[model samples]
Target: MTIIQFPTAPALNASEPHDLLLETLRAATNQLSQAGKALVQCDSEPAARVEAASHLVSAGQSIVAALNAYQRGLQHASDQAAG
Candidate 1:
């Protein structure tokens, strides 16, 4: 029998989650912008163009949702720290 050991991720500190989320938000925004540009440059059929646009819109919606969640998490953390 062969035994394999995998390295485990280090535990996150208190502020890491917020930082990580912010980083993710930034990446998502960049991706959304790139997607928008691609949609604009796309010269495919009307249906295909519409589908690309729809995907860009969906990415925008995801960014909005993530921002909202991040804000709520920060507020909750602040409240907890204050009390």
Candidate 2:
């Protein structure tokens, strides 16, 4: 089992939506990585592999959504700062 080390999370301030989005992105990425690892370890069992593949697909979708949300949050912050 490979442990992924993520950088220290920013302090959560209720006023900062970016911090929350960043945390969501990190968590979704970690989940996706774990799902990929699980699929790799499914061995020769076709049923198990299929189940793992399903989980991987779900994780992939989650990461994509998280990334999009984070990107939008950053853009919003930039716009606010530019005002």
What clash count goes with each model?
0, 0
lDDT of 1 by residue, 21-60 (tens): 6665665666666666656666655655665566667666
- Tens digit of per-residue lDDT, candidate 2, span 1-83: 33333233244453455666666666656666765676676666676666666666665675677568768878987998999
Best by TM-score: 1
Runs with alpha carbons beyond 4 Å of true place in candidate 1: 1-17
**CA lDDT for candidate 2:** 0.62
RMSD (CA, Å), candidate 2 to true, equals 6.4
- lDDT per model vs. reference: 0.60, 0.62
After aligning candidate 1 to the native by TM-score, how far in Å is the CA of 55 from where it should be? Answer: 1.5
What TM-scores do the predictions have? 0.61, 0.57
lDDT for 51 (candidate 2): 63
